[model samples]
Target: MIKREWAGETAVIIAGGPSLTVEDAVYCQGRARAVVVNDGYRIAPFADLLYAGDAAWWDGHQGAPSFAGQKWTQSKVAALRWSLRHIQSQHAYGISDSPERIHSGQNSGFQALNLTYLLGARRILLLGFDMQPTGGSRHWFGNHPPELHRDSNYAAWRGWFDIAAKQLVCRGVEVVNCSRETALTVFPRSTIQACL
Candidate 1:
């Protein structure tokens, strides 16, 4: 586990929101980089890092991106957990080849957000983490099929995001629900200009 230091106050966090300001973009670079979440990995060029259950980290045969990179560590009370050992076999094909960086042991959304919080960041922005699919707004799973699962598509995206947002706020790590389209109303929600 890459346990981040609590006292150092490092990095920021961005969801896959489309409206990230240039200032936030700059914050993701240089020394103390940022850690983006989920599809945040694909659209985003930088995030000090990312986290997910072992299954989400990749596809079994090809090692391309998959829903595993965006899943909760453990299935919710309503959902069921599936085997992701296939990802392990494709280890050589991912961004971080190390075994430790991929497996999600048993973290739900709370656990995943906590990984970023442990960094002791001064600021963490939950960008357009709007979990809703908004009719046709697609997700990664829709573009890439899960090799061993069923119905892991765009709609489930909302449930995972809601859990993660709630987890972040419950832990007192400021989370903003900036997506005008997704009215989850989980947190108070806010908007702030990135410091210029």
Candidate 2:
């Protein structure tokens, strides 16, 4: 579970997409709960929460930030815990994954989105969720590392994203895509200035 819930507050999910800006991060720092996903920490080093789901990332991120928020991941072992695991088999083959402690297999950013809702943020602003290649790189950090293996057709991935967005909205979480140019259009678009 998150150390504390932000029940009536807003959350900013910082994805590693190139559209993310340092100015946005700085502006949202104290104004909203910042949930940084995976290597998003490289940009928003002062994030309120850090979530890295892939086991490989955990093994390699030896010097991640020591933020006040606890690190979150999907655990293989089933137990009563705060951070939940995303059952991959359930999400494969076009199955609809729920936010009830399990996540959709879209990507780490999706997992962080689930975590933000689970932590009780009534409003969420998605940052850097470009969901496309930028300058030959999959993320703002640069090209996809040779070691990582993530392959999904654009249509299938979009379906998964749509499902997750629907669930979040149904549960009373108002989600907005703050990226000026993002492939994800499931949620209504908003500007960082307007949100601030």
Candidate 3:
């Protein structure tokens, strides 16, 4: 089992969404533990952990050497590299309480939330989890390269989070969505400032 090293602490998950900003990343630095998902590390390099589900992302970024924190993924090929922590993947909905693996919600952001919980955070604050596109752009970084997948089935992703929310409540974990704008309403909403 993963040790509850951060028990009772608060964690902030930074995701790659249009609503994310450098200011938001700056505010999280030193304020609380952070987990950056996919390209979020570009803005929050100081994040404690980074999670990406796709192996191609790691390959394209050359293993994200700029990020000094621990890297995690469910991709076995990517995890084979010394820099990453490999958590097995389970095809299911809701959070996986077991430390050995995680439920693949088919999105890196949702998986990052489960990782934060496994790290022993009692309270989790989400930023940039906008499940919908903004200004015709799907992510803050614009779109992925032509070879990579660019489309997101946000409706399906949101459903997974809804299921995860109920599971988290049962575990006594508090989750608050602090995105400036978002379509994910499974958790209670709060402003980043209020959360900080």
Candidate 4:
């Protein structure tokens, strides 16, 4: 079973952005309790992720040959078509975000973020989760970086993250928008260091 040490510690969901590095992983190594993998798209290259959720966000692309051989341990929260296979097994969490008018068939950090939100974290820092796909999709995961592609779900995810941030702030949960590119529209909350 995947040990959720970060259950009570500060947890950050590592998105598929081109900014992740050994330094960041090393920094979050002991500091973070668990990690949430939003999607596996080219994420397997990194492999060392320590998240409890490996939810797949790409829907239509499920048939893509690239996904056939990917592997994830019990720490995965398979979504979409994969969810169809695991839905009866209890891994499927169903449609996370209600409606934001975005092509979510391949976007959303709900499972990971929601997991962190409910994990009793003192504070949450959204790292490289600039869901807008502005920059690249997770760097330092491997020696070769992926050719960055701006997907249609960027703005939608950005809006969704903003909404969640605001909701968490209202519920007394400290939400920090550390995503370098997209700034959240939620109410201001204390930073990670402040919460500590």
Candidate 5:
């Protein structure tokens, strides 16, 4: 089970949307606790946590992510030699209130949201959660390696996020979308500087 280590603090989750920039990640350093999703660690290696769901990703990284902080995954069988915390996965939609597991929402970004909530973050900020292709690119670092799924089911993902937003509100948690450009309209928008 995860501990409420960051109780009442703000957490930032960084995704790999094309609208994301290294500057965005750099700006968040020391400002708030951060969770970098998938390859987002390349830009924000100093982030507090790294989360990925695909086992293939773990395989590609040789089961050893370069991230310095905690590395978390929903993948049941990660190809890791060292210990990696495996959080239980629930249904695909909505947020899981339980601290022991998180609803996948079929994307790392959404899962990171559930994680931050469980970690006791009262406010969560989303960066690079565009949820749609921007500037003709799916992600800031470009497409994943050939073996992994590339296309995103944006509609379904958005629906899941919408449900999660409402649930967070009911729990008195605050969520803000701080992406520079985004298709997600479920959360109130704000600039990273303003949020900090």
Candidate 6:
């Protein structure tokens, strides 16, 4: 449904990492098209799009907080096991021949990035893509409990983003990492203020 929604326009993707601050949320609200990641809705209530890859996450939220933007869940075989009720792109299966599916990143942020590209965002700015915890919170929402995700799978996650970044850049899209604290170095780092 995101056919050229922001063609040649800028889009800000808000991830749930701790680096995602209230200031960043404010900047995206009425400025640019906001594409929020799972649980990021708590911050950017008016997000233009919401993306969740893991089915368990949908179940855990129990769909408590409804979103106004189109909610997308990965259509991969494993992701459908949880449920597709009330979500878009459920029946879509297999992988696309597009570059977004090249490495088929597993994390929600990377997946959201690919979707944004498909949606026609020429310049995409990232916020809260810390890729690691800051202080005590793994996420701005405090949802990623340590007990559940012990390992954090840093290497695998980074690798996926690395591949995805290269593919997107080669395709002529500018992916800027606005979260300066992020461990991910694949994308050129920039400040949220600068991108805004």
Tell me the number of clashing residue pairs for each predicted model: 10, 1, 0, 9, 0, 0
TM-score of 1: 0.50
Clashing pairs in 6: none
**Tens-digit lDDT track for model 5 on 125-184?**
999999999999999998988988667899889989999999999999999999999999
Regions of model 3 farther than 4 Å from truth: none
lDDT of 2 by residue, 1-196 (tens): 2322778789899888777778876778678888898887777777877876666665566535344565667644321233333333234422233344546556777777766776778899989888876555567676545565466355655667787777777778799999756888899998877986
lDDT of each: 0.42, 0.69, 0.90, 0.42, 0.89, 0.72
Which is superior by TM-score, 1 or 5?
Answer: 5
TM-score of each model, in listed order:
0.50, 0.81, 0.97, 0.53, 0.96, 0.81
Q: What would the C-alpha RMSD of candidate 2 be, to one decimal place?
A: 4.1
Ranking, lDDT, top scorer first: 3, 5, 6, 2, 4, 1
Residue 4 displacement (Å), model 4? 10
Candidate 3 to truth, TM = 0.97
Please name the candidate that would achieve the greatest TM-score relative to the true structure. 3
Better of 1 and 4 by TM-score: 4
In the range 1-196, model 6's lDDT, one tens digit per residue, is 3455678878999998887888878777777888888888878889988877766676676643577777777645324553342223322222223533422355677778777887788899999998988776678877664433545666677877776676677778898999847888888988878877
- Clash number for candidate 5: 0
RMSD per model, one decimal: 9.6, 4.1, 1.0, 8.1, 1.3, 4.4
Worst 10 residues of 6 by lDDT: 86-95
Q: Which one wins by lDDT: 4 or 6?
A: 6
* Residue pairs in clash, model 5: none
Checking candidate 4 for backbone clashes, the offending pairs are 6-33, 16-137, 16-138, 17-137, 17-138, 18-138, 18-139, 35-51, 54-77
The segments of candidate 6 whose C-alpha lies over 4 angstroms from its true place after superposition are 75-103, 145-150
lDDT per residue (tens digit) for residues 3-112 in model 3? 67789999999998899888987899999999999999999999999999888988988889889998999998998863688888898989999988889998999889
Pairing residues by index, what is the TM-score of model 4?
0.53
